[model samples]
Target: MRVDKYLKNSRLIKRRTMAKKACEQGRVIINEKIAKPGDEVKPGDIIEIKLGTGSTKVEVLSIKDNVAKNQSEELYKHLKGF
Candidate 1:
């Protein structure tokens, strides 16, 4: 999945556009390197997101086109949270 879509589908960010902006601003990293919005993300990849105050790290577990709000958290595992 694309990083931006993954972020939104997983509910990491509130919207796809916001996730894209975050990537453009270098606030999103994949496997420790800065990633573009269209970067491909897969299972076991590590993703870090920089928020206003702090950052969060997550490990991708699975990829799905759509998920319910209650099931979104299952898409990735939270490694660390700020």
Candidate 2:
């Protein structure tokens, strides 16, 4: 899945646009490399997001086009974050 979509579907970010902006600004990283909004993400990939003064890290667990709010957390495993 696309990183922006994954972020939104996983509920890591509130919106896809915000995720895209974050990526454009170099706030998103995957596997230790900077990530673009259209970057492909898969299971087992490590994702790090630096937003404002905080940082969040997660391991991709699964990918889906659509996910329920209650089940969003199942898409990724939180490695570290605020």
Candidate 3:
């Protein structure tokens, strides 16, 4: 799945546009490198999102086209948040 779509589908960023913007601005990193909105993401890949205060790291667990709100957290495993 595309990183932006994965982020939205997983409810990590809440919106695809925000995720894409984040990528464009280099706030999203994949496997330690900056990511583009169209970058491919797969299970087991590490994703790091940098926010104003800190950053969050997660390991992709699964990918899906659509996910329920209650099941969104299953898509990725939180590795660290600080």
Candidate 4:
């Protein structure tokens, strides 16, 4: 899935446009490198989202064709390594 779509579908960013903007501004990273909104996502990849206070890091655990809000978090697991 595309990084922006994954973030939106997973409910991590609230909206696809927000995710896209984040990526455009270089606030999103994959494996410690800046990632574009179109970046493909896969299992075990690390994703970091920059925010005002701190950034959020998650490990791609699984990818769903589509997910519900209650199940969105199952898409990625939080990482303490960040």
For each candidate, the alpha-carbon lDDT, in order, equals 0.97, 0.96, 0.96, 0.90
lDDT of 4: 0.90
lDDT of 2: 0.96
What lDDT does candidate 2 reach at residue 9? Answer: 96
lDDT of 3 by residue, 13-66 (tens): 989999999999999999999999999999999999997889999999999997
The residue pairs that clash in candidate 1, if any, are none
> Where does the lowest 10-residue lDDT sum fall in candidate 3?
48-57
The digit string of per-residue lDDT tens for model 4 on 30-62 reads: 999899999999999999999676889999999
Backbone clash pairs for candidate 3 read: none
Alpha-carbon RMSD, candidate 2: 0.5
Q: How do the predictions measure up, each by TM-score?
A: 0.98, 0.98, 0.97, 0.93
Candidate with the larger lDDT of 1 and 4: 1
User: Compared with the true structure, what per-residue lDDT tens digits does model 1 show for residues 1-82?
Assistant: 8999999999999999999999999999999999999999999999999989999999999999979999999999999986
TM-score of the candidate numbered 1? 0.98
What CA root-mean-square deviation does each model show from the true structure? 0.6, 0.5, 0.7, 1.8
